[model samples]
Target: MLKLGVLASGRGSNLQSIIDAVEAGELSVEIEVVISDNEDAQALERAAKHQIEAQYVGPEDYNNNQDFEQAIIDDLERNDVELVILAGFMKLMSPYFIEHYQGRIMNIHPSLLPAFKGLHAQQQALDYGVKVSGCTVHFVDQGMDTGPIILQAAVPVKEDDTEESLANRILEEEHRIYPAAIKLYAEGKLEIEDGRVRIAK
Candidate 1:
């Protein structure tokens, strides 16, 4: 079974979805541990509820971003995690971390990706006047949301939608697709070539 290590910095609804999927036997992976930059992150609470190890390693603890990422590497190594998932970790990981994990790191973004990456994706879509918005689960790289996408789910951007409302819609799709993407990765069905992801035939 694949061992999953999660990095999150906030509410961790997406993390919860992964945990639920694993517990329900939908995902053939075990959540080894959860690490958060925010000491008060609810992701810790979720991990505690599931009896999984939860760690809080704030920026102050590290001398630099590289050190911070090294700490994560150490933690993942200790847990023997085969895959690292970034659910909502706000901090940009060091390029070294991306290099170390390579294809093992994955993340979910609230946009089509190669689109409104970095942040405020819903607002960006609204401002850009796009009628359709969505969420993407992609491999993590040094560039923000620029890695090969594993899966995506489209959501309609309504005319009267506020950022919060639009985010809510995208989040629902995120919960569905993120787990599906991870499952694909676990099943060895994802193929990346020329920056595009193809399901193995």
Candidate 2:
């Protein structure tokens, strides 16, 4: 079984989805640990429910970004984590961390990616007046949301759509596609080829 580690902030709704997938045998993987930057993050509660180890490495305690990411790398090594999944980790990783983990790290972004790369993707979509917005799961690279895409689920941007409504819809897709990507990775069905993800039969 693949040993998976999750890094998240806030309420970890996507973290809960991974836990649920593992519990239901939908994903053939073991959750080694869950780490959060926020000490009071509700993701810790979700980890507790699964009886997995949860850690909070606060920003105040770290002298630099490297120090913070090194703590995460150390935790992954200790737990023998083969894959590091970023459910909602908001921190921008440095080149050191990116090079160390390379393709080992994965992240789920709120927008179609290669489009609105950063925060408040829903707002970006609304402001741009796009007819469609989506979510993407991809490897974490040096640039912000510039990694090769592994999975995407599109949601229509309705004429009456507000940021909140659009986000809710995208979130629903997030809950679906992220777990599916995890399942594919666990089964070794995802192969990075020519800068694109090829799903095997």
Top of the candidates by TM-score: 1
**Candidate 1 global lDDT:** 0.93
Candidate 2 Cα RMSD (Å) = 1.0
User: Residue 98 CA error for candidate 1 (Å)?
Assistant: 0.5
The digit string of per-residue lDDT tens for model 2 on 1-201 reads 899999998899999988888888788899999999988899999999889999998878989888888999999899999999998888888999889888888899989988998999889999999999999999888899998899999999999999999999999999999989988888888888777889999
The pairs that clash in candidate 1 are none
lDDT of 1 by residue, 17-132 (tens): 99989889899999999999999999999999999999998889878888888988999999999999999999988789999999899999999987898789999999999999
TM-score of each: 0.98, 0.97
Angstrom error of the Cα, residue 152, model 1: value is: 0.6
After TM-score superposition, the amount by which residue 198's alpha carbon in candidate 1 deviates from its true location, in angstroms, is 1.6
- Tell me, what's the RMSD of every candidate? 0.8, 1.0
